[model samples]
Target: MNTINVVIIDDEFIVSETLKSYIEEYTPNLNILSVINKPNDAKEIISKLKPDLIFLDIQMPILNGFELLKSFEEINFDIIFTTAYNNYAIEAFKVNAFDYLLKPINVNELQNTIHRYYLKKKNNPLFQYGQVKSLLEKINTPNKTERITVPEIGGLTILQTSEIICLKSDYGYTDIYCKNGSKITSSKALKHFCSLLKNHPDFYEIGKSGIINLNYISKYYNEGTIILENNIKVSVPRRSRKAFLETLQIQ
Candidate 1:
């Protein structure tokens, strides 16, 4: 068994880490190289790391898995796409026989995918890369893109506007807190995202560092703070209080 180096790219931290753990624990000669969640960083990492296999997530924000593949002139390593949705399964397999793992990855399916790769590569040691455009073309395009594209460290996170509870700034980055209790730390500043989401009327700026979801407000406090549905308290600074209160009243 050759020591195969592996890199994983997924917007979800838990999903990417879980896949890393599963590969390391179950695969005989697999070496988990790196786990990245940002799509922009993936290209640089992939070029520098030079992993034998890459576990990629398909529906990342801004730049998707397919877009990433299209950027490369020639692919040197194998790619296995991980997708949460099932709509792309048949088309994914159709494109160059590349494999895809549905979210909540099944243990047996994972083993089979790895085994298939080992068998194919063991015999040839040279796997040809496939064209991503054909499959991408046939896929459904959203009539209106309702998801917010947030650029994070290793990849991009595509989240529903409703799912986001608030945006909190820390140092240079913005923390996107979700209703599901997931937080995405983005490379961009809070103001940048605040501007991008300006079209969405529900986002409210609390003071200088906080942006709260008006739809998820639990209660407003006398201290100019508001509690969110998930018990997260967002403070409204004195400067923004009058406008904030007015906005709340109108809503």
Candidate 2:
């Protein structure tokens, strides 16, 4: 088995050391190339060493994980985010198909993640740099409305958030309907998109498995159903009915 070169970038010394020890103990095939505690120095070290994988912390003083990633013009290496962020932020990671470990990392989870990484490397040698780039763009641009990157088999499809008509959850995947009558199926879960579009004024979660663009809503029935553009109809659950009506300012 070939050894996988790894780098740990965390501002906290103890956290970084704990992760280092965990990798050394649990994953013998993984080689710890470097343990960087300073976010400022990470760029230079990572550029020089060019490890196969990086375990990056999201919260740091000088530069956070997203900011550090933005500094890199091209992300050739794979990233495994290590964060103590809340559920909303974790959803972003899931939507982007990025692997992440929560703080005080579980040994079993870490091992499993590494195993998955090995399998991914074996099956698909090419890393999806587009995902990382899209994530960075979302993080860097707070004012602008973010575009959604739909991950297809061959590559990624960037869609303006406004162009989305509605999304329906099919098992674990999401089917996105667009205004131009194009539908894109994404491997990400519905809850991920829910979190991703939570801040958007137009996008609203109507039912357990459906999200609708309020701007495209053409009709709403008192019986708890809404008709959006393209003749797409979605049911609004009782629990969400009040809030949905309130959003529409329907007295």
Candidate 3:
């Protein structure tokens, strides 16, 4: 197996060190070229070493991962972004077909991500710098509509917030129901989507495990039951029933 040179750029010392240890112990095919804590020095080091893959952190002082990439005229390396769950960043990565690992990194996910990268490299020699460029543009542009990236088999599915009828928590995963009569299972937890759509006007949390889109509501009963599009029913807990009814102006 050919060794893939790698560089890790994260501001947190512990995070970078933990990742380094995981890679060293688990993935023998990947060589750790450098673990850089300073985002400012990353450009010079990356330019000098020219590693095959980069493990980049999204939020950093002085220069962020996106800004660091923007400094490059032509990107020749693949990137796997590391970030604490940020809806916008995750959406951008998914939309652009880039790989990302959520922080407090899971060892199994790390190994799987690296394995997938190796497979992709073996099958397709072409690098996707255009996707990176597009991601940067998306970040810079103002979006009027809200959207979320649903992780599916093989790749990601981008759904407009309006298209979603409701979200149901199924243990560790979230089951998303769409207006188009399709269901998507996402690895993200219910709280993740709740946090993502918190500020949006149309989405309301029905209980601990469900969120329903206000626009999709077809009927609401005084007994704290909501009937949505496609005849889907969601129950509102007694504690939140008053607020839920007020939101619908049914009182």
Best by lDDT: 3
| lDDT (Cα, tens digit) per residue for candidate 3, span 97-132 | 788888767899999998888787788766456677
What lDDT score goes with residue 209 in model 2?
Answer: 89
lDDT (tens digit, per residue) of candidate 1 on 1-251: 77989999986676787788788778868888889988889999999999988998865666667778778776888878886544445455555567778666777889998898888887777654544445555653322224555767766666777788999998999999899998899887887666555546778777779888899998988778789987887888878888988998999
TM-score of each: 0.56, 0.55, 0.56
Model 3 lDDT on a 0 to 1 scale: 0.82
The positional error of residue 153 in candidate 3, measured at the CA in angstroms, is 38
Between prediction 1 and prediction 2, the one with superior TM-score is 1
lDDT ranking of the models = 3, 2, 1
Error of 2 at 18 (Å): 0.7
Off by over 4 Å in 1: 132-251
lDDT of 2 by residue, 16-57 (tens): 887999999999999999999888999999999999899998
User: lDDT (CA) for every model shown?
Assistant: 0.77, 0.80, 0.82
